[model samples]
Target: MPQLYLGPWFAILMFPWLDFLIHIPTKVLNHVTPNELTLVGTEKHKTESWNWPW
Candidate 1:
C-alpha cells in the first residue's frame, strides 16, 4: 500500500508552529540574553582571601 498521506499543505500548515517552536526560544533569548554574557566566556571569578595581616 502506497501511503501518500502527508503533503505540501500539511507542511505549510505545520511550518509556522514548527518555526515558532524553534525560533521563539531563540528570539526570546535574543531579547533576554545579555550580549556580553551570551557571546563571551566567563573566567573563574576568584576573590583573594586575605588572612590576618602579620
Candidate 2:
C-alpha cells in the first residue's frame, strides 16, 4: 500500500524520532478521502446509505 510506504518517507523527512510508531497507524487509521488519494478517478460507494423512505 502506498500509505505504508508514505508513512516511513514522511517520518524520515518530518519526524525521525517517532518513526513508524506514529506514522504507520496514523496513515492506516486516518480517514483520508479517496479524492485526495487518487487523481482522475471516482470513489466507489462502499457502504449502503440509510435514507429510509418512511
Clashing pairs counted in every model: 0, 0
Native-referenced Cα lDDT, model 2? 0.70
lDDT tens readout by residue for model 2, 1-54: 686787778767777556667887678766565345546558676997799899
lDDT (tens digit, per residue) of candidate 1 on 1-54: 334666866887799999899989898888886566554567878899979988
lDDT score for residue 1 of model 1 = 38
For each candidate, what TM-score against the reference?
A: 0.42, 0.23
In candidate 2, which residue pairs get closer than 3 Å at backbone N, Cα or C atoms, i.e. clash?
none
How close to the true structure is residue 25 of candidate 2, measured as C-alpha lDDT? 68
Error of 1 at 48 (Å): 28
> Candidate 1: what lDDT?
0.79
In candidate 2, how many Å is residue 35 off?
12
